[model samples]
Target: MTPLSPDILDAVAHGAHHDPHSVLGVHESSDGWVIRARRPLAAEVVAVLDDGTAVPLTHLRGGIWEATVESFPGRYTVRATYDGTEHVTDDGYRHSPSIGELDLHLIAEGRHEELWRVLGAHVREIDGSQGVAFTVWAPNARAVRIKGDFNGWDGSGSAMRSMGGSGVWELFVPGIGVGTRYKFEILTRGGQWIEKADPMARAAEVPPATASVVTDTAYEWSDDAWIEERSRTAPVDRPMSIYELHLGSWKQGLSYRDAADQIIDYVGAQGFTHVEFLPLAEHPFGGSWGYQVSGYYAPTSRFGSPDDLRYLIDRLHQAGIGVIMDWVPGHFPKDAFALARFDGEALYEHPDPRRGEHKDWGTLIFDYGRNEVRNFLVANALYWFEEFHVDGLRVDAVASMLYLDYSRNDGEWAPNQFGGRENLEAIRFLQEVNATSYKRYPGIAMIAEESTSFPGVTAPTSAAGLGFGFKWNMGWMNDSLQYIGRDPMYRSHHEGELSFSFVYAFSENFVLPISHDEVVHGKGSLFGRMPGDHWQKLANMRAFLAYMWGHPGKQLLFMGQEFGQMSEWSESRDLDWWMLDQPAHRQLHGFVAELNRVYKDHAPLWSRDHDGAAFSRLGAPAWNPNVLAFARRDHHGNTVAVICNFSGVPLGDFPLDLPESGTWTEVLNSDAEAFGGSGQGNLGAVTTDARGSATLTLPPLGVLWLHHRADA
Candidate 1:
């Protein structure tokens, strides 16, 4: 055997080498060419050249075998006899590094916008060999190896080489292709070995199994026209009514493709312009509803493959419906198989316990101050838009990321450098992500679920603001639901709760969201919150829906609420879809469809949502009658007048001032009998007096929408 350094040989034997390829593949020695192979538990090792010449190699110390050949072979395979059986495969170490220097430079600088293209397990064809290339970032690890089903879950022979100073490890194994499962076995700096799923995996095994899958996409998108039209129109200018749903609980066993076909038709028929999904990122516990993400890049395998998700989005676009996904960049669960304790250090999370840990959620907060960590989240936001063709991202839990003392006691947290509770690093990270997302994908919406009085949340980043496209009107949701849950008699005394939202309605672009959060966690279904008997509860719901659509903002309704599902939402079970069989539930379902229809057909309700002059109160709140009247005006001088009556008694000869009218037609009446109401309203039209005022009978616990006819 040719002489080699003893330390180098020992490192190879112990799988502790920083650069294993230097000592394992074919090398030029003073005495001709030497071929080296590592095959543990093998009885014999042989080298097979491209010309079909097989040469036996002598076993050296510690699973190392070598032979001095007369000449160099352009290509070769390694053959090993294990348990009296011979297995031949292409030499994994013979290939060059799969990642380039430019990629390493960009990664080191934390400026790789397409980071997913270089980091995960990807199938590639390099140098006429078909195989899968695996790459990961583990700068604090002593060594790393690839372990998977191809190697019988053993990694002794698949040790990877570290790309110097880049914190990246890579290997291209030439026998495994797509669908192969794999994970990284890292020897931490403390000499402890841990297995971790790829942080950038495009697909993952269904939970209870934590292996990353090798994947590639060949989907031909059919949404060019949709993309072109979307880029030209601002989301605020278009009428947006979103139907938000959890895919797993919508129909328990449906795959992505199955849900797409059903959801496309339902959303289209109901007249919703868009559909929002709970986070589809891969996660371990189904109970989290995908909020605690394990794979930032992978579509959850609970539904289907990555390409299957692509097909779902493409089909929705073809049907003229936009797609928005919930994105959780706030924190992640402390699962041992995920990013927790990765590299035996707090690599992905903040080092300080006060800043890193979320005691309330039992999760770890991200270290937004870290450049590489910020890049991971920023590129992740772009990945959805660039790869999956999603039109928007509803950022989850903004308040938690913004405040340092959130859910913490006085002594449990630390203040920022400015002696404030604000998280400056997290603020900067959000601004960068929002600005980058909008700059790269024109007309894409970035919505924030912030519940605080934070200033300039929806303002432009150039003006030193957060740059979100819209902010959820959480105060509006809480106040409105609180007011409606009261008895009709007591509601009259608390009318401020219903009308106070308008005082600052146009302060920021807003979405009035009745999200899944309001329906879960022991909070009963929306129907159960209406404080009344069955009939009055349905009527109250109808009135609330009408008011929500007629208000000055976009609207998002959670699933199962349209049909008055009687039970609280549960991720463990499907929605109460069978409730539609009842007469009242069926009628409420039809009522929601009609409400969406009237909302879209009128420009006044949505076109000037952000202009304060677009909305005006008809008069002071009617304390005794429990009625509130308002009007919305569009830029083109069109008007929509809305009257909501919360009392159980119908009001006769109720005078309401009109914007301008000779005759006003009842465009939509929640009491029209078709919606299972008492069917009392202004017959079909009401004539105004010389003062532009009309006297009409408002139904009990109902709403009415009136529009002036041009000819009148």
Candidate 2:
């Protein structure tokens, strides 16, 4: 058997070898050089060198064939014949190392910020033959093999070699092309074998199926102009009227390309500056709404390939709309073939279940303290921005990641090294990712969907903060929803809820989000939550939304809320598009579109969203109580003022402390007859007095936007 050890024969047969490259590839044995391969179906095997020197191979017991050649390792081919078919191919192992040593070092050290370029499945040319470089980090695995579609599902044939000292396993398989379905077949320490979909796969089979697809990421981007412009401007201190929609349910069953055109046109017509998709990453269950992701790197194949998603974002950019996606890094699904116990141990998660599992979410929490695990997550954030050209990531479930005791009771969670409930390692990881992302991707927004009192979330990292560009105002959403849900008779008792946001509005750059969470899971839709008959509920929605826009923060309202959906939001079906058939709903939609226009046109509303000086109460909530007013100002002067009344009765002369002494033009009135309101308002314009104040007629369940008309 050419002196091949029995141990080598046993490993080849059982697929338990950790260093198959040393045996199967062209190796320097005592007898010159020899090339070997496992070809179970082949009846005969031969090695052919570059000089046409054919060497016949001996058929060893375990479908292993090898031949000694006079030439050293160089360009070569292997010819294997099955029943009647002849398969000729270049030697997959006779090539230079696909991954460099420096890359392995950085990956081991967890500083490979662009690890996507070094790890994962990438197509590269080696020794004049194009193939794939497959790499994965699985330290606890006894052995790993590439289960390629071309491998005839052989677990014993394509065993990958573990790089020295490093946990990463790599193999350069010649003739492996793009679009090849592949996975890692891992041999556990206990000798059990299991197949896992690639965690870093850039493409995936449509779910209910768990195969990873090799992707060609050579997308020709057409958003150079948009990208260049975005590099100079950030969302802060700018008009940011965001339209948050669930991708799968937005207009059900549409490809990324088709949906992009339809959504972009609608968003543009509505004057929204950006569109936010609620978690586009691939997840096994559509019911999770992409929150419980399995394939973090792959865009769900339900909409098309990664390229198709790129086309969607590119098209949105060309149409002057920025795209943001919800990213869930707090926890991942415990799918057997996914990240859970990734390599037969808790490699990606904490070994202790108390620290590693999220009981409420039924998921595994990442071990942020682990170097490789942290790198995997941080790199994924950058990939979405750098590769897919996304404008921002609305990091989901930040509260779960920031605290150790999140969703856990006493004794169910462990404290930090400092004996606190804070997850210090996760905090450091967040800081590093935020700092690195800001350094690498200028003008890209890092938003936190945190719902706690965690201070300085949007503060600069240098200032001892989480270093996010913005933080969602979840408290405002909750308090205001509860306050607005009450009848007008009882609102006075809870007036503080209506005015409480200003207490800490500037603590962080805030994005006031009325997201899908508020309208789902028996919470009822935004329209349904209001207190009244049908018309009054619609009016309440319009009034509350206008108040949100006028508040000192960026705005993010979920889809269907704009058109006044009556039922709760459902991912199973499309938003209540048929609601627009009703005049009240159509008018509500128009009101929302105009609100976007008014928001974009006025600078004061957005110019100093983080500065307290840019805003001040006009009519205090305590006075007339049901009526509230506020003025939004820019550095130069006051640009607009908003007045609202939630009472059932109108005030004949409602007074507001305007900042500008000019004719205040009624820019928008939610109570206009066209908007299904009673059409009550000041005749077009009202002049303010010398003291910079105006007494205006405030309609019931109404909102008024006034602009300083200097020419009037």
Best by TM-score: 2
Poorly placed runs, candidate 2 (over 4 Å): 620-622, 709-712
Q: Write the per-residue lDDT of candidate 2 for residues 1-712, one digit (tens) a residue.
A: 3576888777965667888767776888776887887777688888777788777788876878887876684777888899879898876656656788999888888899888887878888887888888898888889999886888877567778888777888888888888999999998887778889988888899989999989887789999999888888777977898999888898899999899889988999888899999899999999999999999999999999999999999999999999989999899999999999888889888888888999888999999998899999999999999899998999999999999889888899889888999999989988998999888888889999999999989998899999999999999988989989999987778878888888999889999999988888899989888988999998898899899999999999899898998889899998889988998899999999999998888888899999987788876323777877878887667578888888877787776677778788888898988888989999987787898767788888999989884344
Error of 1 at 585 (Å): 1.4
Which runs in model 1 stand beyond 4 Å of their true positions? 53-55, 69-72, 82-84, 620-625, 709-712
The alpha-carbon lDDT assigned to residue 644 of candidate 1 equals: 94
lDDT for each of the candidates? Answer: 0.91, 0.87
How big is the RMSD of model 1? Answer: 1.9
What is the TM-score of each predicted model, taking all chains together?
0.97, 0.97
The CA lDDT at 490 in model 1 is 86
Compute the lDDT for candidate 1. 0.91
